[model samples]
Target: MSTSVPYFHHFQKDTTGIERPVRFTFPFCYDPHELSILAAEQVQTYLAGQNDFIHNFGLMDGQEGLVIGKMFGVLVVQDQEGNLGFLAAVSGKMAGSNKHRYFVPPIFDMLDPEGFFLREEEHINQINRNIELLQKSAELKELRENLVQCKKHEEQILSERRKLHKKNKAERKERRIAQQPCLPEQAYQELLEDLIKQSYRDQHHYDVQKEKSTQQIKLAEDALNHILDQIEELKSERRTRSSNLQNQLFDQYHFLNARKESKSVLAIFTESKNIQPPAGAGECAAPKLLQYAFNHQLTPICMAEFWWGSSPNLEVRKHKNYYPACRGKCEPILGHMLLGLNVDDNPMLENPAADKELEIIFEDEAIIVVNKPAEFLSVPGINVKDSVQTRIQNRYPEMDSPLIIHRLDMSTSGILVLAKSKDAHQFIQDQFIKHTVKKRYTALLDGLISGKEGLIDLPLRVDLDDRPRQVVCYEHGKPAQTKYKVVSIEGKNTRIHFFPLTGRTHQLRVHSAHQKGLNCAIIGDDLYGKRADRLHLHAAFIQFVHPLTKSLVQFEVKDPF
Candidate 1:
């Protein structure tokens, strides 16, 4: 064959009688596995000094113009006329420009088909093909039909065989019974023999079953007796405990009522008797004596010791109070003589020896409110010591065990409520649990808040890693919300009026401190804020319907913040 002509590549198209320089480079289509280093080097050398441009030359749609690799080449003037000429010129110019600007040949790169990731893809493709083949296989289809047919046939054969076998066996048994010898005496003898044998067998079976049933009945009776005995024991124990508790309650009630009755004695000692006293003794009047008794919990020994001096020759004799006394009783005349007022009345009698006095802020038949001090906790905590609960316990010694419904923080100074009766307690507690109680608080945060009003909708939940610390977790947190409006902005502090929508511990404190971009907490909130002497938050108002009267009850405290 003649030597192949070196073709001229034209750079212009869509014009008549035009000639321009155009570049021509080798075009290649290769699978990743077909790539060779020599081919890569040749492409690189040829494309040196050329700008980069991508051209798709593939059978697949939407995949041709992707960057495959880069190469550089220069175009020499050529004579041609066609769209291909124009396209070649434009691509060559682009490639040259990239090469000149970037100082590197334009390389066309493509994903290698034989790469490990692509091989996995290929493996998946092959498996899919195998699955498709299996789905479309004629043998599988024919085998499935054959299996159905064979199963149906086997069922039919088995059914027919069973019927035939059953009929045959029944007929054979009947024929054997009919073929037996027939003689009256022999028949009777055989009948008698069978009857005797059946009777004996029946008796033996009955005896065994009867013995077993008798044992079972005995066991059942014993179990029932044991159950009855246990029930009796339980009843006896319950009766004993009930009697003991009732007796204790009775004794305690009598003792308290007796003290109340003794308070009348104090009144009698002061007003009715008109007993004149020495200097300053009028202060310890009968009411004062009764008040002291109420305060000191007037036990028999305490009452005797205070009234009568410790003299052995007082000639004391036992009377009404003797049985209550363990050993000796005070003489009535001696008690009366000692009970008369004096100017130098004992101050100890005026004020009881008790450590603290109960300050009852509000008291009614149903409810009681107490203004808790700063350091004391509102309710019993831990061992329930140094709390409002303990104070109430000592104050209301006449009441059965008192129940505390709600709590405030230890440092929080506000009106605390208690229910006197169980019914009232349940009513108030239900209102709280149902969120019918409206509570508001005033707090001072450490920074000047810009917003006049805003709502914090951030959710909160207990932090698992840190006890007592609440965390913000949008995806997995309980919904906690607080509505806050700025009341006043003073210096570096902002007073916020807060209405909590949810009752989570430390919700407002944590939200203010942990909010994004506005990380200012209430002053003196140690857990969520910088150290301060005391928290600047205060419970300013509490409102709820009264449990007993069903009247609207509202309480307010001056905001400390």
Candidate 2:
């Protein structure tokens, strides 16, 4: 607490035995370095005993306000004098303030009373209030109701007129048909002329009535539009002001890289994706940490981010568990900030299945079944193009249809069915689409499950902030259901069978890891759980009607682990 630097904290315990990491941590996906973990442990210890703050993390009872957990980060940094220490940061504001005595300050503080953000925000809020007041006014309400009634009245009057006109025309037609056979030629002509005159009179009356009704409706609509126009003007002004303020704020968030080069948030995003920076782009823990390190002349060694307190309702977050920096917000920011520093390479760029081979389990003229190895891609990916699909297409040059009928996660090893012809593909793909294809996956869970068998009905969607990682989102997610039966309990791991009823992306993995489902992560699930040698998930059995013979066919492959 008494260091020369306000946010820097030296290690309380002896650290002579631990070696410093040679390169900085990769923010997106990483295992926390030992030093980074130690720094985080110390920060957590301070959080436990602190009395200066009142944020409700939902860790203890009787805490006031919303139960929002936070992502805390630790950056292992060395000072200008080569002193080993670390800096801590929270993702956003803590206890409604950006300045904490023990943590690094935000890249830009929008909460400052003298700042333009607050002043402009207040103006926008006033616009909102004005719009709300006008919307709720009795005059506006009455106008809206009057317009509705006017429309109804117009419809009723027009309907009656049309009905009467139709009836009169039908009667005239009947009279003409009956009179034509009985009356003399001159008499029939006179009768026809009289009927025509009657029809013209009816038509004239209907047109006059229609014009009157339309004018009434138009009058009501104009009255409503007068008030609505004012409201719309205010809304348009508010939108323009809000957009300008956001752009100004983005400009104010200047970030520094290891090379001492500076760039605003707006420039960084513009250069990267040609889009405006997302809200809270520069406010993440990683950006704040790197910004402060550069400003204070601290050499960043490694970094780690962890969640503390209760998990979010839609996303899975465990207390005190390490998480990668979000890709959506921090990827571009860090891409600029980490320049000139020797950061670890992104692991996603490396193909895990580059050296692994795809084993053919069964094959025929119409279809091919392969025992796909773990860490293999079902199809070509962004960085790596070598996959089962590519290999199969190369092997069978004469096959004209898309080879993969079904897919497995790159980390998942299992039986995959491929089609040789377009007809075969459609026939089998239809079965999967209709949920008629039965599949069973074998997975080793990191934790023991108590129940024997149960259904997990958690919905899933891709975490927009982190690609490829799915979160449980009821509002926006596709239905994902999995039935699991525990096969055996081995010391600390539970082997289970998963029968997925829906084929949503990462369905089985998210269902197993989510707290609402099994509350256990699949072993070696790097995206949802801790990293290990390989993901312990396999498509062990599959059953479907053969596309060629229209006969029930099944395939089974034993899992390696």
The most accurate candidate by TM-score is 2
List residue ranges in candidate 2 displaced over 4 A.
Answer: 1-3, 154-214
Alpha-carbon RMSD of each model: 41.0, 3.4
Steric collisions counted per model: 26, 0
What's the lDDT for residue 175 in model 1? 45
Query: How does residue 261 of candidate 1 score in lDDT?
Result: 39
Per-residue accuracy of model 2 over 331-431 as CA lDDT, tens digit each: 98899999999999898899888788889989998999999999889999999898999999999887899889889999899999999999999999999
Candidate 2 clashes between residue pairs 3 or more apart in a chain or in different chains: none
Question: Per-model C-alpha lDDT, please?
Answer: 0.47, 0.91
Candidate of highest lDDT: 2
Q: Per-residue lDDT tens digits of candidate 1, residues 1-561?
A: 111112222222233343221211111101111112222222334343343444332223576343222112122211222122100111122322322322222121112354343454455455455555655667556555555565555556555655655665566556446645554667756765765565566556555655655565555555444544554555565566544543332222111122243322233334544542211121121222223223333311111101111111111111111111111111111133233222123221231213433345678888887765544566555543557776777677776535577776665556677888788888988888888888888888888877888788777777542345567777777888888888898899998888877777677777677644135778866455543666777777788889878998988878754
Deviation (Å) of 220 in candidate 1: 52
